[model samples]
Target chain A: MIHFNDVTKIYNSNVKAIENMNFTVEEGELVIMLGPSGCGKTTLLRMVNQLESITKGDIMLNGKSVWHSNKIEMRRNIGYVIQSNGLFPNMNIEDNAMIVPNLLGWDRKKMRDRFNMLMELVGLNPDEYRKRYPHELSGGQQQRVGVARALAADPPVMLMDEPFGALDPIIRTHLQEEFLQIQKELKKTILFVSHDIDEAVKMADKIALLKGGKMMQYAEPARMLNKPANSFVAEFVGQDRVLKSMSLYTVRDLANALTLKPVIESPDSQNINENLSLRVAISKILNQEADQLIVENDNGTRKGSITLDLIEQFLHREIKESV
Target chain B: MCSGGDLIVNLIEYFVSNFTFILGYTWDHIKLVGLAIIIAIVIGVPLGIYCSVNKYAASTILQIASIMMTIPSLALFGIMIPVLSLINEGIGTLPAIIALVLYSQLPIIRNTYTAINNVDPDIRDAANGIGLTTFQRLIKVELPNAMPLIMAGIRTATVLNIGVGAIATLIGAGGLGGIIYQGILRTNNTMILAGAIAVAVLALIADLFLRLIENLFTPKGVKK
Candidate 1:
């Protein structure tokens, strides 16, 4: 667990890079720092690892002040992944992944086993990539290696600064889903930085929205979208927030909250799984020009039919109850 | 005035008759160039790394090295002679090696500085982020990434030193340059050609040898 107790950052004795910030990242949770560029989100994330110094207050890791911990040892225990992957060009995939383990004096065989396990976790074949240099891999592949390297020591805390910012949209989305899957099993307390609202909405268990070094809101993605702390967050999350909020609710969620319409056999109706988000359901309804989409369960049983009107009622109820 | 064909014949005759004499001078030339390059690397590489970390030192040391290169080699050697005379080692191998070492400094140091400085900033971030101590990062990441360029600097110094080392003969340090000097004194074009060819050949061989070493030391991940 990481706690920020009235943290602030001042640059050159005058410029305030971050204001009095207080937050907590609970164990096994992912908190995303979402803000515009120069909002000090990066600064806040870096301060946890001592990459950036604090001017005031204290940051505590597991009830211990980070300032009092040995910088190298402290950093080794916190996994860090950055944009551009940061894979050492001088090391092959396995060696790069094994950096922290090797430094911690893990035995060679254990490091090898850890490397293979991490590679598999990140969806790479350990043996096939063990000998390959970073340059030999594609950008997406290299990012996977970067993630594998960060998890090598299995640190309980990981900090990611736009880790998927460099990839194209398709690859970026793919990696995000894969990372979410990884997070489910590992449950590392993560503080991730991103400027994209959709990514924050999709992945963040909670979003810490910032503006000009001030926290605009720190709440769950659903709350932030449903009831923005202020106009700044509303604008930042964008005017299409209702549409954006649709992604947070699955067709199953709409069905559970409000009875979806009974299926009326229409040739134009599209078939969508109940596991898919209401965002997909809405899009299918509009794109296919059908009155509804037949939502099916994993076992291929008809759960219900989801229409655009049903999603609207569901969103309204969700907002009212959360308030 | 000898014809080109006659000069070739004379050169072959000189080679056949004075093979051992040529071999001894070649050995002397190799020794001088080799020693100077090794010493320059020892001094320059560390200095370059130091400069990369400290801004003031980088400017001061890089300026001094560049200025050192601008000095005429003969004049530099002449200056070294007087400077070393205080220790009573005015001429011969001492002054020659000192001058050669000074002449070789700029390329070695400058390349080292650039190489270390240019190691992608992102990689440095990753190294630090991953908890590599300063020393560990240098040894494991920075130095390995900096190897090819540092070796290039050494190669530049080596080749440059070989050509300049021939001038050591003027300071009473015997080398292939002595043969050329003798040829000049006797107006023997064939002897001059023999010495020039031997020096050029030595430079080529040394460069090739250093290239092999560079390849061996370069991390395979960065080969391309």
Candidate 2:
């Protein structure tokens, strides 16, 4: 739904922050602009909402040129979340979350209902938090409120600039999982910016890796990990690309790809959900020193057993097939 | 000089006899200070908001306010006499109000500018990103956040003006200063003490009143 057409950003008429960037973010797709700092990822994302001015080219949102669109109206329709959570310190939780809706002139009852629903969507208890200020909230709670606020108006597209970057690692992971679940239900077109590779891989439908204001590689996480566009892409994806790509598949995926070993029930063995990722399986095997793990469905039906040897074979088969 | 106890009783007697006189001057003092402060707020607050927006004007405006602050209140009153005389308002309440308002600007403008300018940049970014127009951002976001510091500025201005209002009697503006000046002319320490004490009491009361107002106006979310 969002398309960048030969976009360029040059600061002070000489410092090129973004150089002729061209990409399309498909509808309902979460496209992550991933890169190290100063790769122009943030500048690029801000260009979508016209927060940053375009030096040379234009960006179109749903075929309407963003530069030519009414800036205020266009932004009101697009949700924007930043790393700081940016909850207004002077407002209570409900007021902060319902900012856009209130601006759009939703009546008090409608705003109240929307605020409660959004808080629930972001895993906050609206009634308990409605009167509380941003300062009264924990970092994670504040960030949750930030997400709810962005989604308050139920905008068609969302621009999140490292929304979870400020939280501690544990909280960050929890929020990421919760956000992915939220995205599944809402399916809003999202342009997420992140410097962390694992975050991009875990949450992005497509990864647009950038370097020094240039697009390095733009592909699915699995494809980018397996077949990098260039040397920089491979290195940027990291030396452990195989292991990183392993996170993309679940125990169920492996079972479907090949025959699993018959279950050898043992008192010391741990049963893991079949839907869990291969990365988790690897960690369990190495940490518990179990030769194999019994995989089960949600109802505790034994699917089969998966061993380290079996996992290796599955990876090879998948790589070979993709190649 | 009488004994300390005798001095105390004598002063109480003087207060009891001239209670109505003291009350009238106190009312005049309140009116003079109150009118000047209200006028200063009306002019200084908008000018401060303007300075925060226009970077080029901020330096010039702030410098001018600082200079106004540096001028002695007595000198400011003296300058007001000649300048306001051309407008047919040379003496009395007009020149006194003019002097007090000029003295009030530095704190009000400085504090307002700093308060608005220093509103967390992140919040400002979020405000703009969420599609608030400039005017709405100021009213709903920046100004509400700025209320505490802006109120602090007004409190400072109010207290400062109350002390300086005592000087208005020098220019024939009737306030508690008139009582103090008359006492000085007659060499009566009791009258001087009463007027001086009244000005001090008025400053304390004004500050406390503003603190209450500051509490009322500050957003609950931002209260420490």
Number of the top candidate by DockQ? 1
Candidate 1 scores a chain A TM-score of: 0.98
Candidate 2, chain A: TM-score? Answer: 0.97
Tens-digit per-residue lDDT, A1-323, candidate 1: 99999999999999999999999999999999999999999999999999899999999998889989999999999999999999999899989999999999999999999998999999999999999999999999999999998999999999999999999999999999999999999999999999999999999999999998999999999899989989999999998888888899888888898887888997868788888988877887778667778989999999779777778788889998778
What are the interface RMSDs of all the models? Answer: 0.5, 0.5
lDDT per residue as tens, model 2, A1-92: 99999999999989999999999999999999998899999999999998899998889999999867999999999999999998999999
- Candidate 2: give the clashing pairs: none
Clashing pairs in 1: none
lDDT of 2: 0.93
Alpha carbon lDDT at A85, candidate 1: 91
TM-score of each: 0.98, 0.97
Per model, state how many residue pairs clash: 0, 0
True-structure RMSD, every candidate = 1.2, 1.4
Compared with the true structure, all predictions reach lDDT values of 0.92, 0.93
